[model samples]
Target: MAAEAKQTCYEGSSVQSFRFFLEHSGEHQAILQRVHDILPGEFKRIGAGKSSLDFLGVGSGGGELDVQMLTLLQSIFPAVPITADTVEGSSQLTDNFKALVAKTTNLQKIPFCWHIMKCEDYEKQVKAKGDMKKFDFIHMIQMIYYVDNLSTTIKFYHSLLKNNGRLMIINEAANGGWDILWKTYKKELCVDAITEYRSSGEILACLKSQGLKYEEHVIPNTFDITECFNPSSQTGQRLLNFMTATDNFYQSFTPEIRAGILDLLRNKCSTEKDGRVLFNSNLSCILVYA
Candidate 1:
């Protein structure tokens, strides 16, 4: 009998692996830079004439990007109060976000409400409580793959938008490494509770299907995965674990499966340059207006 592969989501080590992935990959830096460039223009038109603004951060990991967006929003509307709500499934991440808020001097004036739960659970709670809070800005970054139903989740969030409000989503591009990874190994790697392995392409299609208008921007990024080829490297092992979304992937799966994944990641999903394996981590940002 074949042993079942364990999911990283259930392991405490997944957090460290995720942090390592973010540190090694250029995805975060590229998105941060893009956000800085785009938000000034985007915020200019949002919440005009409003005395206050409500911002929602769905699956906001650690709140670094959320804080950056909030800072930009505050700058655009200095006199207006902004209430920030964050939904994160990880307790450790929520605590890290709260700790960041405590240290940030500018965020002291802003009111923050933290929901330590998954987006589905949060939605269920909202329905159960009949919560009718509309948000001026809602941002979901690199987190859509965890959703149970893509279209339903999008429609649910879109319904929470106020007039002229915007919902921003950042996810991997269809032609990127993630798409290849998921498409190739979904049956072998993506099992148990994890199912949705979507990208920006699906998001755009969903928006169009619902007759919603949206603007899309591609953000080119890469992950230096040279270490992942090194079997003895702990960092490389962690990176592989994160990339595969499995805890100790090399140890969990059969050697044949491991070799196949490595080959695909090295040859198909990444390009080698100067002895470095750079995985295509290109992302897409979709902006949908209410």
Candidate 2:
């Protein structure tokens, strides 16, 4: 669900997917159109139809990305049964995910299963009952924040795959301006310093350590002011919550300090430009072996 108006327990997990879907899907779809540029040999490896794909997502908050993935998969492998496992701690928007499943069209008729366990735990699960080379494809999106050990997590994802299986990861570019924004969020807006891990290199390194090769995608996205910061938008409301909530944030900040920061941000992120508010988002993604 779009929990922009509330203090989402899922944080950036699901909102990123939904926001991108709503705001940038048109342009972003172009990137999807050029998927070959990103996956190259891996896309060819997914091969023909109905191949089993075990979709693994860590920090899958509200699952909008699952919807997108389902669409992508259906286009290439019609009627293929996909087993989706999402590791999310807790989210105020859980109900939104249930709704997403019901409305999904991409893999609507295909068999789909969702497991709400931790990604780190999948290592043990694979070792316990299943063979390492079972799934055909695996993916991890912007949910790396919840991951405890990147190397360990990647190794496990690799272990779960068949020889042809591949892994994919998408996240904000670590060197982008958003890095500073995230830093500020941690330094100025919370009840405590957020211990949540959010590093892109660490994830890539983990995959490399597992002897998995990957391709990277660098694209631009936006967060419109009307949608993200407008007076009535859900995201706008969430921003208001940030304006008001001090003790629950990661910065160990007092409420007053957060309010001051938001005041400046609101002024900078204007909402009168397009019919919607807009801000540039530089997005980077990588797809590796499963």
Candidate 3:
């Protein structure tokens, strides 16, 4: 399991997996549609009688999701201006987001600020600023694994909310095929890492323990991994690296281990129907209140 000690897998493999998921896989689109269905009505209720909106996005990635969500918010209160503060850990992604913002004329109309740091770092900076504003809506999408303490991080974000403000979180659904694979891969790698795979169930449990009330939405999603069945295939290799959170997992791990992982993915995690291999890649969205 130990290819090299103190080395990280999240930087390369995980990021590439996300890129693949967003581009090739159908799940991102499905999830976005679901968000559109669920969020707009809720935002309408929240924005009732309000003059303007304040938004904070944690782990906003390349701002593609941010733009989609903020668009929905804009549609709700077309006349009101929205001020968004976003925190993203990757400088490359932040730059990409900035570039996207530069090209989009509509995005230019919304006031947006970027913090090229982790959520925790942004929290410290928020404190140091001495004049911090509460947000009407905070969204953390599929990036809680990087937080030092999940409960603490959620609490901190929740604390930064205005009265009746809401915090939205999205993650893999518990007991889903993707969740099972993440658990299996983490056990196989045996790495003591901060970016541990966490599902919505675990996160909601933490919220429940903290006595928070929230609404839950399930978004159905799927990914085609037919290429992954062939070990020599580039797509297969990259999928394996992403699944196991390691680079060159096929070369680094023993043949038996590789077979075990592949068998799990091919047989248990994916369903073959109509000559296509579809992987169950469902995700969940939890809306917590302050």
Candidate 4:
């Protein structure tokens, strides 16, 4: 019944998995800090001349990161009002984001539209409209992996950019802490029909092959998953499941395979320093047409 119920990993508690990621991993801080450091300069170079900015956020999550990025943009162009169009596939996440916006006084001031559909669906809708609207800035943060066709998704989003507009994509770098485990268990764990586990290196290669130009930035970050070493740790088990994009990885794999994966996660993927198990989970950002 468990196996029968498990149709696709993504259809599970994605919001819970995302919450686990933010709570345990340093991704939120690392991403926000990188944007605070790098995005201002990029925005300055663009030099806004209009009174309003058309911004599209693909998979903007629960508006936590969107608010930060929007605030940064406001600081850059203090006079211009931002018209934000957010795209998110998860209904729960979209509702949470809207709720946050409704409760937050500052977020209410910013005009926004929500598209509760997948990127491809949104693309089809826009194309069908006959008068497709272009955006000045489009950002996809750690969301590309959700799409099946990375190349097509990138090109589609790139096509939506106005002249001198910027499209920023953030994803994991190749050979990171989880690379070995991912390579080993991907066939069994990954939902290839919906998700493609491609790192930044692979993405760069794709861009190069397609003759696309972009700037890349590597953000150094780590997360503590020492609990994963303990067989009895439920949090560790969930973390492993989230990392592998599987449902209960500890129970999914055979004893031998599970042991091998745990060993790799402990020794190769992470290191024990000062009594803490730190993982080598860094991220990278690729700025296209910035």
Q: Per-candidate TM vs. native?
A: 0.94, 0.66, 0.91, 0.92
Residues 1-290, candidate 3: write the lDDT tens digits: 10112232224445556576466566568778888888887898778888888999898877888888887888779899889898887776777788988887777888888888878888888889877788999998877766778988988899998877889998888877767776787766646443466788889899999999999999888878888888678887776665565667778689998888778887888889888788888888899987
lDDT tens per residue, model 2, 1-290: 11222332344533454444445324345334434455544544674544565655565556665566656665665555666656554453455666787787555565544555566565666678665536666666555654566677776676667666776776656654344344456544322223443546566666666677777778655554343334456555544443323322324346675565444444542324646545434556777754
lDDT of each: 0.83, 0.53, 0.78, 0.77
Worst 10 residues of 1 by lDDT: 1-10
Using lDDT as the measure, the top candidate is: 1
TM-score, candidate 4, is: 0.92
Model 3 residue runs over 4 Å out of place are: 1-17, 190-195
Q: How many clashing residue pairs, candidate 4? A: 0
lDDT of 3: 0.78
lDDT of 1: 0.83
lDDT of 4 by residue, 1-290 (tens): 00111322123475677687788887889889998888998877654576677889998777788888877787789777778899987677778788877887766678888898888888889889867778888998877666767788888899888877899988877888755667666776555333346678878987887888899999888988889888799989888877766667777779988888888888888879988889888888889993
Between prediction 2 and prediction 3, the one with superior lDDT is: 3
**Which pairs of residues clash in candidate 3, taking residues 3 or more apart in a chain or in different chains?**
none
* Ranking 1 against 4 by lDDT, winner: 1
Across 56-174, the per-residue lDDT of candidate 1 in tens digits comes to 99988888899889988988888999999998887887888899999988999999999888898889999999977899999999888778899999999999999999999999998
Model 1 ranges off by over 4 Å? 1-11
Which residue pairs overlap in candidate 1's backbone? none
User: If ranked by TM-score, best first, what sequence of candidates would result?
Assistant: 1, 4, 3, 2
